[model samples]
Target: MRAAVLTRPGRFEIEERPIPAPGPGEALVRVARVGICGTDLHIFNGHYAAESLPMVPGHEFTGTITALGPGVAGLEVGRRAVVDMNIGCGRCFWCRRNEILNCPEMRQMGITMDGAFAEYMVVPARLVIPAPDDVPFEVLALTEPLACVVRAARKAQVTFGQSVLVIGAGPVGNLHVQLMRTIGAAPVIVTDLSPERVRMALDCGADVGVTDPGGLRQAVLEATDGRGADVVIESVGNRALYAAALGLMRKGGHLAAFGLTGPEDRLALPILDTILNENSVAGSVAGMGQDMHDALTLLVHGRLTTAPFTRAAFPLDEIQQAFDSINDRPGDLKTQIVLGEEDTR
Candidate 1:
């Protein structure tokens, strides 16, 4: 087996290793496609807190089960599947409450543990969700990020005919726009610094797109009939964007922060305004078990299209180039690494 190991920050080496065997209640998957996420970039830059050294940093992936360990059930060999990255300790207080993301002993694949940046990886059977065979591997690889967006949307509690303002038109922002529409959010508005992404957001069902911060406020107000947005989702993890998102919401509107930021990152907001306006702020990270299931269902039903957001696929040998494409190309939405030559569709 061949694996790309990040021995340190800004360094990766392709090395050969013995194929791993599945342990009890685990499964060995032949990785097909892996989507590079922003967290992977942070890990590559040594900024993400949970990532350790000499790790394989790829959480969003799709593969075929090659071997099932003892005690595994409901999963068979040769089934196409996607693995949930967040693995919570069953004994944690949060896990007991079914809030896996809040578990202090949570271990995420590709961050704390070895991931699918290789030809094969071993994963717990319970964390593997069977993917529809009809969907392409590239699209199936995106279920992880889409699941995160699903969690964010649920946290927003968007109601019918309510207005939503997503502050960023990246892949996650576009997913938010589409999900908001599916959930009955009307006149979804997206704002991004890149005009190309703003256009992409519109293509993804956003009623309005704003490329400039100067126009974003006015656009939101006009779209909501001067009342401002009912929900504001901040998908860009920047301090300025966070502060601006706080201002884009209506009185008593909900604000969902879906982007990942550094542990020490801080935002200076008007505490008095938040109190007086009775605004609700919530932070949502990775998706839960149900979110993953819902996201995969949406994808299988053709409700969510990842084709427009997907870029070209790169072979595993060009892993460095894949990371570079994400850093250099702002317009590119999803960059996939193809581990096998078989047609994943």
Candidate 2:
């Protein structure tokens, strides 16, 4: 087996290693495609506090089940699948309540354990979900992030005809736009620093895409008929964006913060304004199994398409170049590493 190991900050080494055998209730997957995300960038830059060194830093991936360990059933070898990265302690209060994202003992696959930045990976059977045979593996790799967006949409309680303001027109932001549109959200406004990303957001079904924060308030007001947005989602993860998102909501509107900010990051809010307007702000992290299932369904049925977001594909040997492409191309949505030949249905 071949794997790319992040030995340290700003460094990666592709090395050969023995193929891992799946433990009980686990399955060994031959990774076909892995999508690099913002979290992967943070880990690569050594900014993620929870990520340890020498980790195989990739979570959003799709593969074929090469082998199943003892006790594994239902899923068979050669099946196309996507693996959920969140591993929560079954005994935790949150886990018992079926809210694994809030589990105190939650461990991420790429952060706390080895991940799919390799030709093969071993995943717990419970975390594996079957992928549709017709969907490309590159697009299927997006299921993990799509699941998170689904969770965010649910958290915001987005309703039909509601106006949504998504702060940041990145990959996640575009997904939010499409999801909101799918549910009849009107005037899905997306903002970004890059003009290309703003255009991409518009292409991804956002009704309004603005690059200038200076004109955002007016844009939202115009789109909502002088009222603020019904829901505001902050996907940029900057303190400034956080404060601005709070101000963009209508009275009694909901704000879903899905961005991953720095550990020491803090935002100054208008406390009295929030109290007076009855605005609600919620922080969402990762997704539940049901969310993943819904995301897969959406992809399988062509309700959600990642074609506009997928920029390029690279081989495993050019992994560093793949990481560089992300930083060098701000407009690029999802840069994937193609590890092997994908199943052609």
Scored against the true structure, residue 84 in model 2 reaches a CA lDDT of 86
Error of 2 at 247 (Å): 2.0
Residue-wise lDDT of candidate 1 within 186-212, one digit each (tens)? 889999899999888888789999998
lDDT of 2 by residue, 1-345 (tens): 899999988788998999999999999999999988888888888888344888888998899999999999899888899998888887878887658868888878887788889999998898899886778887788888899999998888888999999998888888998899888999799999889988888887899988988999999999899879999999888888888887788998998988878779987767887798888887788876888898888888788757765658888899998887677876668898889665454
TM-score of each: 0.94, 0.95
Over 4 Å off, model 1 = 49-51, 268-276
Model 1 per-residue lDDT at 246: 80
Give per-candidate clash totals. 0, 0
lDDT of candidates 1 onward, in order: 0.85, 0.86
